[model samples]
Target chain A: MDSSASPLSHPFDNAIRLTGSNGHYQGQTTAPYANMVGPFGGVLAGVMLKAVLQHPQCQGEPVALTVNFLAPVADGDFTVDAKAVRTNRSTQHWYVELSQQGQVALTATAVFATRRETWSAPQTPYPGAPRSESVPAMPKVPGLPGFFANYDLRLVRGGIAPMPQAEARLPHCSDTLLWARDNPPRPLDFPALAALSDIFFPRLFVRRQGPALIGTVSMNIIFHADANTLARQGEQYLLGEARAHRFYNGYFDQSAELWSSDGELLVTTNQVVYYKE
Target chain B: MDSSASPLSHPFDNAIRLTGSNGHYQGQTTAPYANMVGPFGGVLAGVMLKAVLQHPQCQGEPVALTVNFLAPVADGDFTVDAKAVRTNRSTQHWYVELSQQGQVALTATAVFATRRETWSAPQTPYPGAPRSESVPAMPKVPGLPGFFANYDLRLVRGGIAPMPQAEARLPHCSDTLLWARDNPPRPLDFPALAALSDIFFPRLFVRRQGPALIGTVSMNIIFHADANTLARQGEQYLLGEARAHRFYNGYFDQSAELWSSDGELLVTTNQVVYYKE
Candidate 1:
């Protein structure tokens, strides 16, 4: 899929496509979006939202989504069952599950709300990160998650691994500032933003060196921008800031923010990760 | 129902009790826990979690739970259907829905994890809020939600309402700090903490004067302490701090921290709320 391709024909759309019958949908895992264990968590999260949005009974736009990665998903065929459990005049609630080998691998809940004009304010100050041109692009490492090749990441700070073998120091804080845009340069949408929510590396890796058995236990994301805001920023780099507060007893939680280059708060996300050192 | 009663006999237990046969459970709203238009969100959240905990197939302790308030629940008999969508040796995923009159009113997904000893640290420092003994307890105001009597709240700051028509100024920040405990002194546990997650008043009320139609759209809570920690803090007041980062276009989000009286981090919670003026 070329970066210049149309949104309807993008690989991301193809990767998350599902054929539905009787409220159950089926999709196949694509090589480009595979993670070390299975499909990328971000992609999976996006696919779950897609499942909900594509449902015939779906309403409004996504405002909140929570995804629980119960187990590792193997690359192959998968099934998603999304149900709009409740529909209100202004909001809708959905429950979605992804299953492989007839066992559930992921479970998620989402709230979609119809937006209206009202008093508004954003209290989180923009990171004011350096422009994308000021930061060097991350060198793609071989043998990493297959999905790595699908993102173009430029590090502004806290670039720990894949170092040039010099100037390596233990990160003073588990904070990362970067600029990221999907590789085929897809337009900003719920699914794209959902996938981008998990774009940051594990906070452990950001703070310490070396690998560990790490998996995201749960992730919650709230979309702060509307469809117009996202559509206007299509294929452009979005500033991302991520930091962790606690790492304890095999688990740690982190918070992140994604902002449009012009300073719009696109999304706020948080997740808890499990690590075995 | 007495504060000094054993955990088994506490009113919190009675409030969340469900009678089930073959995985479906039925519960009714208790007057003591009714909110403005329905039961308290925290109580509803607790009951949803209770459904999972009481499930015969429940696997481990809860680590994360996300609840979506789909609609305004009416006071009456409601049914909860809890499904163990997936179970591994170490963790289980569950999806639950609370329905009334055959309409879904609330939906939630929870992740329960088996714990193991490992490296541990809490990065967020203790807030060191003033002792409960020093702060004046909130006066029970007439015409408030019936559930207001369920908790004993002591305010250290951000006490905007219930004033005696003096010492009231526009709040400068949407931050609240106080000591809170179950009025009936129920022992600390997952359900109690879940209920406490929504204990704070809407930030809109905290930041501005007057009333507005406010509803919690979605809430996510991550449990930071183990069962032992909660058990040891039994029936003790916990320090709570809540603040918001944004209030935009008919919605706003706030994050909160719950700490034991002695400074142990217990739970971190975040929620997005809907408002109309």
Candidate 2:
């Protein structure tokens, strides 16, 4: 991989100067570099959610972030800035924005719950489907067109292992399994984990005939349990499956399952995809 | 039933101003209205998409539209203005926005495909599930809860229907149906259809048992066919069922089937719901 030309260093990220480039700091720009294409409207709202969670003012626990796509982000260098609109001991609200070259592309204002260190609580999650331990190690599918390169993937059962053929839809009852991981794993922080929203690809079962004609806009993750447990498990591969999908017009929504190899169904994902096939 | 004090207006129709709000017109204010709370944020983008298609200097062949939510809309009203960014006989690019209100609360800049009207074409939609030929429609569930009174609804499903039982896992087979209608049979025009983006409720199926929940902020719609045909079908009822949902961090993407009363699979709806249920 060429160092300077990698997709990781998007045009937007590089435009951030150390002190300022119209209205941002260099440090702030690199934060979203982790996930280049943001949630929707071409703004880094998806990444912004994570950053909001990591804010210092939150007191309870940051669990969810919902963004309303207000506009199509103009193409060019931009900035994402957030201000704590409201705050207290337990929750905080933030107003954010994406300005392209200087014009606003998308704007988001949200609330975040804080983590309280003094609270003691019982821990358990709904009995989810057993987690599968047979997930093979993740493969390095770098920007290789098939895997989107951000996550390491291992095909356990239903991968279009061969690049071209995985495009066919499996029978309605037949499902596929695959393992995915983020590089340089750390304590599954909200922003980092949310960034992995692009990881799971169970919908490969929804086969398309011609070219690989599919892409995602944004995803919402429900933290059913402590995501921090991901580090202790010492295992990375997560089993995931697309549960349902409906195609109307030129779009389809695919619901999926994300499970830890240890039999723990860790997360459920639902995404709308636009595929030109 | 009380005429003026009624929350009975059709939200989809051109809403009459209760008080002459400056946000409603142009010149002095470029914004549309207090878009954050009103249904306008999502609807504005939809209207812009439609306006783009109807721009002069091009054939008015209907091109589908899909708007992905990026962030929460800003408070205050904004303007949704559209113009042909690029135009030719075959394809045109249209730019639209809900602007000048706390920055663009919503915007859409896209291309509209136009071809010379060809010989009349054959039309075939799925035989939609049956419904009352002329049922007493439910009062429209205008913009989520508070924002009602702007629109009305007539459930073509006839009357108050029972909500389906909750299921941890989706049905094994892929079959879906439902019936819905906008109150006051307003003329079905592009702008009107765009306004329906606010009407499609993919979140109602999973309303929280309590108040601590968020709803769908972004929705994408793909029109498979022409607008005239869809309107000719009369106030269409929406029938949908999901394929699967991945629940992670209080967010999910649901794939669904959308059908009309005559079993005509009207359109498929793919939505990502954000909630804490």
Candidate 3:
């Protein structure tokens, strides 16, 4: 939609870029795109994936991705090393690690596949939710994750109060349904969608009135749509829904889905998080 | 329980063993354990993980594992190379691969964590299906994957007829609820649970009368039980439930859960399968 803005110059592109040689890459964390600790996990996830996508041996579109956060990433320069572990005629597997000062902070794996047309049936029914245009966007506030400002997020249900008002009333449930689209609208693509996958607020905040320290320890996403399907929905809002199934042993499991407005399931993502009081 | 049978001598233990130095190991496929095209995926998955668990630097218990089947394995010896991608105070990440004739066949990554006691809750309701003891064990027959004999499996619903009687009557839905336990009554551990996670018949077979060629392209599993919890159910049957949410474009995704009879959720696994006519 914004032909004058080259994809190469997009903030997402700049933030996830790598520059180095001999199987290593160097990147710098960007501000205004920063989460509470570092760059948004989704963007960091994109960076890890970008390392592979930009690799000489990379092949096929990403169909699955798993990222494990070993520690908090410090804001500043970091390095990523991606290697293709196995490659078949139609599929490939990769391992990626992001590190700072010779210490590994994040580790990830991705699977790419060349898909062919076949019989399709989606059993998960789309939610009976309202349209994006009918809801007001979540207002940006100080002391919140800066990355929130980069997207137009409209909550349809189960939203937490602002940080300043968080103590007033806590949500009764962790389920959340919302409409989200990147600000300055960019075409829907793998990296953008990957970043969007982690954009939901931690389920802990949604369930409890009080705030707690929380971080995603491991996340896995399965992609169901092809590039053409994603590109066709350029600049349009996608429906997102997330809920936690279990909370245990200082960790919990959350499952979320991203779907096109018309009801095409794009991705299903799950994560395990660590929370501390 | 068979006290005279040591776990090291179990068929499952023998099937997942590897011999080698450093991070590289070698293994061979066993007869009566073969799938339609190669060794059963569950066995291969266990073998890959075995390489890591057996590694000298391996630490902690498995918290998450993701295996990508890049290619089909020939029924013979294969090599596996595993590396500790990163290690932290409480967690370790590993990358593993299975190869034959010097080419990559399958690749996987695992995250091991030292879990601590904390608040726990499982929201998924335990199934209302009948107890496993009341159901009949699936009979072993010719033409099915020989690996089915490795475990004692009893189906409660949405089960396909045996190959000989497959044409007699097919299940109407793509859902399966079964009870499964190691034939030799081995103590359940990470590797054993990993293998059991994939013991279900393909959802496609349950929905369609005839079988089509299919293979798991990728799988991700999250472990919710600890060693104490797993061992407490020693050699007991686990309630296994599986269903597919969508099938499209040569690929479909199936989600399965293994729960202890005492109502503890042990693992939640998901995979994308490629099918062809």
The residue ranges of model 2 lying beyond 4 angstroms of the native Cα positions read: A1-132, A137-143, A146-150, A161-176, A200-206, A213-236, A243-277, B1-11, B16-130, B134-177, B187-229, B240-257, B262-277
Evaluated on chain B only, candidate 1 has a TM-score of 0.93
Stretches of candidate 3 exceeding 4 Å from the true structure: A1-8, A20-24, A141-143, A162-173, B1-8, B162-173
lDDT of 3 at B98: 87
Candidate maximizing TM-score: 1
Q: Please state the error at residue B128 of candidate 1 in Å.
A: 2.5
Q: Please give, as one word, the docking class of candidate 2.
A: incorrect
TM-score for predicted model 2 compared with the true structure: 0.55
Q: List the residue pairs that clash in candidate 1.
A: none
- Write candidate 2's Cα lDDT for B113-209 as tens digits: 4323332211223434445445343454333353333334433221212322223223232222344444445544555554544453333343221
- Model 1 misplacement above 4 A: A1-8, A163-172, B1-8, B162-172
DockQ values of all predictions = 0.66, 0.08, 0.53
TM-score of 1: 0.92
**B95: Cα error in model 1, Å:** 1.3
Q: What C-alpha lDDT, on a 0 to 100 scale, does residue A235 get in candidate 2?
A: 35
Candidate 1 per-residue C-alpha lDDT over B21-64 given as tens digits, one digit per residue, 9 for 90 to 100: 65599988877888889889999999999999989999878888
Q: What is the lDDT of residue B141 in candidate 2?
A: 36
Indicate the residue-level lDDT of A218 in model 3. Answer: 85
**Tens-digit lDDT string for candidate 3 (B1-277):** 1222345588777778788978999878876568888888888889878888889998878878888888888887888999887888877888787888988888788888787776566656778667778877777765677788888987777667653223333335577788899986788887889999999888887777557889998899888888898889888899998877677787778888899878788888888888887
